[model samples]
Target chain A: MFSGLSAFPLTPMQHGVVDEVAFIRLIERLADAGVDSIGALGSTGNYAYLTREERARIAQLAEKHAGDIPVIIGISALSTRDVLALAEDAQKAGASAVLLAPMSYQPLSEEEVFGLYETVAHNLSVPLCVYDNPRTTHFEFSDELHGHIAQLPNVGSIKIPGVPAAPDAASVRIERLRTLIPSHITIGISGDPLAAIGMNAGCEAWYSVIGGLFPQTALAITRASQAGDTQQALRLSERLNPLWALFSQHGGSLRVIATAAELQGLAASPCLPLPLQGLDKKGRQNLARVLDELSLT
Target chain B: MFSGLSAFPLTPMQHGVVDEVAFIRLIERLADAGVDSIGALGSTGNYAYLTREERARIAQLAEKHAGDIPVIIGISALSTRDVLALAEDAQKAGASAVLLAPMSYQPLSEEEVFGLYETVAHNLSVPLCVYDNPRTTHFEFSDELHGHIAQLPNVGSIKIPGVPAAPDAASVRIERLRTLIPSHITIGISGDPLAAIGMNAGCEAWYSVIGGLFPQTALAITRASQAGDTQQALRLSERLNPLWALFSQHGGSLRVIATAAELQGLAASPCLPLPLQGLDKKGRQNLARVLDELSLT
Candidate 1:
């Protein structure tokens, strides 16, 4: 169901609680910017750290603000039962689709992996997108495995990290994957700024963390690429690339979301929960410079 | 509590359901051979392939057969909540301790890592052991972080894999950790055959999959080491080394468990789950030779 640019909004937190007002404003801005879909509580939204009730509330809030726009809820948990429960919650909250990450504790064999997806697919009452981010997962879904996952009845899309313009071996691998999966199944790209390039390389949708910080720029880039204006998309990518690099360099997607929230004046503190050290002073300064250059703050 | 050799018995499967009768018999045999502790549903136990109910039943059965002998439950799961629940169930089922692997999906930050342990520790009544097998989890617990986890109130032990032995640099790092944490926090060595050497190098527990099939030999080696009879322990280790090398050469711990189970007549089909291919004919034959030489059958 995902096409055009999808925004993974930072779940705004104020005083250790979901800041509903700030979150509504963030979603409203993306909707106004013509974002095709909004991903709730994906890695960019810090799904892992949120309590179940908090996550459900955020999904409901996104649905409320999204109106007719599609709200894809990130449905990653350590248990298949939990994932199914979350997917049901997302469906109940009016999510148009759900994104699932495999259980994280043990590296699952393909049989176990298929069983998990089959369990979710058979149970969930909405379109399912398999999230394949090996950086966080320490395990990549091989193209062959992805083909197997695609065979699941409810699986509608695949979300992979976006590739930069310069064709690396990894980029070539992505091209090979595009040729393998069913052409009808959506292939969504994560990793903002490179989203347009990934789209040019046959990805069906672009899910952006940067979209939360700079909705207008993200939308402009996405629309340009959709309208077959590669030159325009490239320019916007260039403008957003520095910030994307700065945020994603040190840790996982949490930093990207934190940076975006900071830029947009959404979250008061850019503090990430344990094990994830916050950006150093130099890193913050670098982000500030990027924001200043973009005239965003 | 795991002060000597620990045997993780394979959960025998017959036509896809847990062969409870075979499983209990295996545990009783291991106990009779003087195994110091019994581990249930470890990687060697084909845990990921088992359903939740099957895994719980295995733990419950192990506890029943264990009697006064310590039964350590492998409480590894994708979700922190599920793992905690498993830990609680394990405690209720008479398990002396629970083992936890890090939340698997992502390379967790040290804070998320500690948070996971804290969640499990706070929720369960029994003492917990942090299972740090990087070969499976694809993540390592750093020496500093290991010390921190060792200090957690309910954390009683650290299970580190025996491979990639502590180098000079690692030895210096762990020495610092040894100074920081309580001396009583048992260090359990996980890689088979290296168990004796690792135990000599400060590890308090030696977990052996081979022990399940050749309990007499496994217990003899462990007892010799416990009595501070290094010569005897070394002799047994030498005898077992060829078998260990055969099982570990291709598939590491999984192959060892499967091969040992076949020799023990515990499992009719010693098959590995997908993504992990089954051992080749030559590998199986080599494993047979080791089992025959050990007089395991």
Candidate 2:
């Protein structure tokens, strides 16, 4: 359940409210596409912007709609009490596992972060994934800290923030991390653009953003890499360079993916929550062209 | 209301709920201390850890108990929708002004951030304080963005993180920022240890954490700096060197300030939101000694 491609679907919002219909459709799509797991309410899902009830409902929806595939629900919050509550909600919703990022408002200390995992991990009935997405959480996990956290109860994986661009360098980075963590704890890679490279370099899982919206494309890259066809994986990834470019130009994948979803009629137009404008007309037009060229939409 | 010493009181919590009684007492103390303004729900107040209902009630409590003093309520959130809601609540609760930090879970672009302030600023009935607190918000505001946001309606101040250590450098830093915005938008300085230096260097206000708890100590420094008695201001700040040392050693001011408040009986013993441990036994002992040595208790 921790390995292979884990697709993350956006919890689409319309007029500042969670669009439940669009969200369930996204789940069924990922489940139908044969993703090994579905990562619900990740950064791409705009989980941070959601209230507890919203997150709980999204977790239940994802768990129910993902069919036989395992679901990993993101349970990150600014406070431990809240994270624990979310984790409980996820477990009760039948989530196979939960993801936690050390989301901070007051910049957290190393001790506080460790304590957060320790407290939550002990209480959790399901497996836990440490989400090390520094871009959003602004909390960098040192390899030493990862090693410590991985040893805690229920910690099944560490979703590292991608590796070096070069294949050999990426392999070396993954191998170094593998040594620190226990064998049972799967090492997954995030950063959509680097998914193919990271999986080819021995990261057991590709926790993907693009996979949520474009599962077949993401699956092709994942399967090729898993089969040791590094060249095929790289080639497929290179084909999606236009999509990656869009992700870069638009400040990460949420807006671009939501834009793609909106354009594809997968979700409502203007799906993003407030304070987060999806894209301007020009960027959306550019995305439309790129999606057309790639045959993604 | 945007200038001089703005004392930021902790919205003290007890067993995961807002300690309204303790919170009210803290506000009344600040009012009695004769602070120029009360900055409720600031980082020191653990505003991000609270619910909208809790924050609204706190804002109302602060406004009502603060007597004639102006109360600046912090209304920052992950989404603009929530921010707008909180802003409306503050206005309804009779807030003199509102403080906003570009809080994020998705790492935002400069354009997105500017759009946030632009959207929130225009909707605000009360004047807005641009909370440039990179340490907490993890979103650094460039001077150009500050200048741009300052031009928006209701933007009355920019609460900068801090200035350079040296007197000459601090003045240069503040002066450069001064040129970026209109004179009506006062430049307030945070980073409690540097309050004296930044205020003396030309900051119109000290958005102080320590001021919330120990009003007399903070006010003396603020008054001296405003009176051009830089030597006296610096001397008073230097006397609190032990306190500053604790802040540096403990990551930042929130934890240390919370610990101080807990020891002083200003709030509950474990005042802060969970996942944020105030201090360990040894650390608290050290804090107690420093508080006693400084005659702060």
TM-score of each candidate structure, all chains considered together:
0.76, 0.96
In candidate 2, stretches whose alpha carbon ends up further than 4 angstroms from where it belongs are none
Candidate 2, A43-130: lDDT as tens digits: 9998999999999999999988889999999999998888988998999999999999999887777898999999999999899999
* Top-lDDT candidate index: 2
Model 2 C-alpha lDDT versus the unseen true structure? 0.92
What's the lDDT for all of these models?
A: 0.73, 0.92
Ten consecutive residues with minimal summed lDDT in candidate 2 chain A? A271-280
lDDT, candidate 2, at B266: 83
